[model samples]
Target: LIATILLYMGVALFCGCGHEALSGTVSILLNYFDVTKGPGGGLDVFTIIDILKYIIYGLAAGFFVFGVLLLVEGFFTTGAIRDLYGEFKITACGRCLTAFLMFLAYLFFLVWLGVTAFTSLPVFMYYNVWSMCQNSSSMEGANLCLDLRLFGAVTVSEDRKVCTGTEKFSRMCVSDELDLTFHLFVCALAGAGAAVIAMVRRITLSSDCS
Candidate 1:
């Protein structure tokens, strides 16, 4: 039960950090680059981000309620509650519910795997830009560029697709916003992984109890 609570806490952390990181990423992209305005245009980027925001909000609320219900069910199935209340049999319906929860946990585990991967994509993209900036001194006269079109964040266009060794890139590299967003995404990735593990453990425990 304690472990389950801890797991839910990890999910909460992911939800909070992921949402903030997404907002930070959007801000940096808009301020430093012409993502939304170009011959190619990027209304799709905004649409995707807006959709993800809604999904995250739903996941946060759904997980909170699901966690509470699962914990309550765990209390009934585990020996702790039985010992306190004297040996009581769980009904067939209770066992079925536990089985259903185990299945649901497995599904959630898969979902978290996808979420972790999605979260890592932005981190990976930012790390490339950050690394190029860090090694700028060595690559003298070479054009260090970040292409949003390559990542599908913006449509393909010659003029606005790439950010070269410009003032914007330099400022973006030095900005606290970029650093904070990078770390936040890293935390969110870790949280997603933790949630995956937690769901696996939950399934195992539910299987045993059922």
Candidate 2:
């Protein structure tokens, strides 16, 4: 309970309530690595790489959550899982196997969500720019850059082909999809955790039954 509270606090701090408005908290980090600007209108490889990096980071974050569960299990190796399932009690190695497997499944979902979100985040927040060519001279030394108009609000480009319409929709969709996955993973993990707790209770009940 305490840990969950702290986690909520941390998210709230980063997301803020209504006092201060903020946008794409993580996209700001990608800006630092972006260099696709100037008169060339060339591609920004660095920014792309960084965005990819963050996607991986997000995925890793999800995996880390599952890793924590592994650490917890390592500390408390109990035989309750075996007692709950007769097969586990009959076989020396079978005891607690099902619980462990279920726990593993929970962790797997977590890691999968982490990875999926990691790659999808930047694409979800991507934007494009557009500009018209009036004269040959303008094309000689003209370059384009994606400027954050309202701090992750709208990425303005020289061409004015803002990534606001289709891009924004696509990104929002991806973010929502990843978010749903995260929530589902959380639910599964919670269920697994609850099962473990129940098994522990069952063990106690069995002892009392005898």
Candidate 3:
């Protein structure tokens, strides 16, 4: 039960931090690039951002409910609960429910794994930009550029380059927003990993109990 609580804490952390980091990332992209008016694309940046925001919101609510259900299930399976309530017999329905939950937990683990990897892509991209800023003194003559097109932020064929030599790029690199967003994403990643482990443990425990 204690382990389950700790794991849920990680899920809570991921939901909160991931949402904030995603907002920050969108803000940075919109502020620096022309993502709002990408030519020839059916979907605008605003639409995509809105979709992602909604998805995160749904995930937060879903996880909270699921976590509560899992906690209750864990409590019922514990020796303490059994002692207090007397030996509870597992019926066919109970067994089926446990099996279903185990499957769901495994599914969530896989989903979070994908999410963690997706979250890392932005962190990786931002890290490269930060690295370029750090080595700006040495690479004086190089045209250090970050293209939004590569990341699918813009569909336009025109170059949306944020170079090291530009004032906007320098300001962005030095800004606390960038640092905060990066750290938040990192925290979110860690949280997702913890949640994955928790889900795996939950599945194992459920299988044993069943």
Q: On residues 56-174, what C-alpha lDDT tens digit does candidate 3 reach at each position?
A: 88987898888888888877777776678685677788778788888888898899889888878878977887778778888887887888778777665767778878888888878
Off by over 4 Å in 3: 37-42, 83-88
Would you list the rank order by lDDT, best first? 1, 3, 2
Q: Over the stretch 1-210, how does candidate 2's per-residue lDDT look in tens digits?
A: 232233333322222211121123233223332324445643443344445446435634643474455434432344554356646433445336535544555554454345335423433333111112112235444443334553333345523222323444234334443344333333333433433343334334333322
- lDDT value, residue 113 of candidate 1: 87
Q: Which candidate leads in TM-score? A: 1
Worst 10 residues of 1 by lDDT: 155-164
Candidate 1 total steric clashes: 0
Q: Which pairs clash inside model 1?
A: none
Error of 3 at 140 (Å): 1.1
RMSD of each: 2.4, 15.3, 2.2
Candidate 1 per-residue C-alpha lDDT over 1-210 given as tens digits, one digit per residue, 9 for 90 to 100 = 765876787788899899999899789878887566434644577778878889989998999888987888888877777788685777789878888888888888889889888888888977887778688768878885677777777666634444546788778878899889988988988888888888888888887876
**Alpha carbon lDDT of each predicted model:** 0.80, 0.37, 0.80
TM-score of the candidate numbered 2?
Answer: 0.25
